[model samples]
Target: MINVNEVVETNEMIEKENLDVRTITLGISLLDCISSDLEQLNKNIYNKIYEAAKDLVATGEQISREFGIPIVNKRISVTPIALIGGAACRTKEDFASIAQTLDKVAKAVGVNFIGGYSALVSKGMTPADKLLIESIPLALSTTDVVCSSINVGSTKTGINMDAVRLMGTIVKETAEATKENDSLGCAKLVVFCNAPDDNPFMAGAFHGVTEADKIINVGVSGPGVVKTALEKVRGESFEILCETIKKTAFKVTRVGQLVAREASERLGVPFGIIDLSLAPTPAIGDSVADILHEIGVEHAGAPGTTAALALLNDQVKKGGVMASSYVGGLSGAFIPVSEDQGMINAVEAGALTLEKLEAMTCVCSVGLDMIAIPGDTRDTTIAGIIADEMAIGMINQKTTAVRLIPVIGKGVGETVEFGGLLGYAPIMPVNQFSCDAFVDRGGRIPAPVHSFKN
Candidate 1:
């Protein structure tokens, strides 16, 4: 039972701070909707998602109003289309049709985004995986509300350089395809390694085949709540600071647990998990980088940033695990430059660099997210970056992703405005050094020896 003090505190978090449920994602598996006929397959896919998610937006609004908790976005994630659509979608155009169907259903159902236009080739690519990878640029550019992802590596199997190389070109094509919108399509495509099965976030979220036929996963956001709490404990010892973060995270996760259970019950679906990620927003108060600053770092890219982030990420999980039993998904701090004002400021001030961000992802939940690079950046260079991040996840046995946007026609020092949640950012310059030879070696990087844990 939530006490009056708890309720009052939660209300304060919502009112004063930027506390809110970041997303209520309905995970709908599309394996059962597969067919050999393209048109039939699309029909089945549309009906399945539209029917399953029909009540999603309304239910989210109802929960927000009744509970006084703001549910920011209602979204959906389907099974990897490459697994099921290969039988029907033979060409890139066919895959675009499926993307169109997804976009149409998402709009019809009133959801903000529908994920799972994805392929998973951690070790090697199948014919289907290749098709999906090749179709990513066309599919994402031709549709709205449809997001895509590809997982090219895992701890169990090393990085697939073939897929990595291909995706670099695909990402460039996506930028070119959506150049009219400031390369917004690149924002909707994420390349991940060790991608979680139950992530409730967009672009990277997908209803893994291992998941239930249908489930509800909620991502809780409260960077402002955490930042506000830390303000009081400023200049305190690390022990005191960790305690403050733990307690704050505990309260935040509690709200998420309640919302997840309520949503599951009302939607008549099983509750998946509460992703207690301190997801930041473009809003002033809701910045994860500010938390780093509060932790005594001058800025997010300062010398102590990585250590500060390490402490924050670990304490968040420690505080969150006790608050809910079904804790899954990437449950830590996300440092998306476009979405976090502090991060944007750090970058603009030249305090943060791409290399610094790479090191930071080593300890954080995700890696180098929402970064905009110069348009003419080499595809080989992009592949090299993805390979490095994948190596981190593979070695650390944790999830790491790269959501890089090569803003077409934009170079360093120029800001691209992707209004709303996809905030504007100064295009960060990349190393002009060539990695063509390294990326050109199209072979798999072998798994680590420690993978023999079984």
Candidate 2:
């Protein structure tokens, strides 16, 4: 199984092709830490995460150094706080206190971010879920590393229009609360339809109630690697092009498999899954859009872009599954606007727009991610957008999420900088058409007829 040529090829991918393990996330369940007493609950949550994740960052660094593979981030995801704090959290402030505790543990352990400040309200909201939902603005504004998500729709359960409407207002409040940071708080809050439990990516990762106590999941990314391989087969037949991508993806996923096994064995935690997603960064040559360009699209949102994405997404899963038995999470291509420079370029070139991006999400890994919209855009408009995306997921039975930032006091044609992994974005315009009457009809959108398959 070992060969010098293979080893050298791997090295080339790492050194020049932007191939790396994106994250090693530790999923720790907080169910056992729940208590009827507020103080005791916070203390228990803090101690549990601290003991479980203290060595995560150091372990990731050790693996990267020894293997000569770059591990970008160490993260932690806990069981949704809404479930863990149900008994003790009486008000929004109580839920926010839990977020503070989570932020404290994340800082102590030195991880980049900690997720699971979330509530699952796909069909209806519990009292605790409502509290957690209402508290997201305060919780995200006050905490540095805590990320939040709300699942407002799912295939099994219909979309909760009430939650969708509430989230629109909450998104606006979150932007206002962090206007000094270019509404960065909204960047950390994702609203999802069919959200996965074991996602290793931030702003959406959370340990589902069904998972083990603690486990290690790894996310791998290699857009440049894929693009480089595709270039070798330029102007080739569709069959040859697809074969090239599958082979390249298999190689990239094997790297993630090795890292996941090593980290799990060393940390004494069970390995969860290998998330072989083509997660791009602000860095050049590391964009999923670039891979699309190599596939024949002039720009990410141009004609045939969705078809190109669907092909890439299918082949990635095909190749990834062959490499690792436990390939899960959002293991495909991510199309975040701010995180991918090519997508930003497409927007500036007028080849991409919010409408085109939404159309693309029907085929990509996630939906409308890291997009900056005008602050004056009505909350009802945001809800309408979320509803449309959620409807896509519910009908198609796939995962779709929205991470939109309504940059306060910013309008279309302006730009806002959200430094680091979240790069700068030009403010995109939204339709001024009124959706108030539509959003005002607050009731659940019943699941599609296909959902009744029993």
Could you tell me the TM-score of candidate 1?
Answer: 0.99
Location of the lowest summed lDDT over 10 successive residues in candidate 2: 422-431
**Which residue pairs in model 1 clash with each other?**
none
Q: Candidate 1 residues 396-448, lDDT tens each?
A: 99999999999999999999888888888989989899999999999899999
Q: How many clashes (backbone N, Cα, C below 3 Å) per candidate?
A: 0, 0
User: Poorest 10 consecutive residues of model 1 by lDDT?
Assistant: 1-10
Off by over 4 Å in 1: none
TM-scores of all candidate predictions against the true structure = 0.99, 0.99
How do the residues 1-454 of candidate 2 rate in per-residue lDDT, one tens digit apiece? 9699999999999999999999999999999998999999999999999999999999999999999999999999999999999999998999999999999999999999999999999989999999999999999999999999999999999899999999999999999999988899999999999999999999899999989999999999999999999999999999998899899999999999999999999999999999999999999999999989999999988898999999999899889999999998999999999999999999998999999999999988889999999998788999999999999999999999999999999999999998988888989989898999999999999999999999
Please give the lDDT score at residue 116 for candidate 2: 98
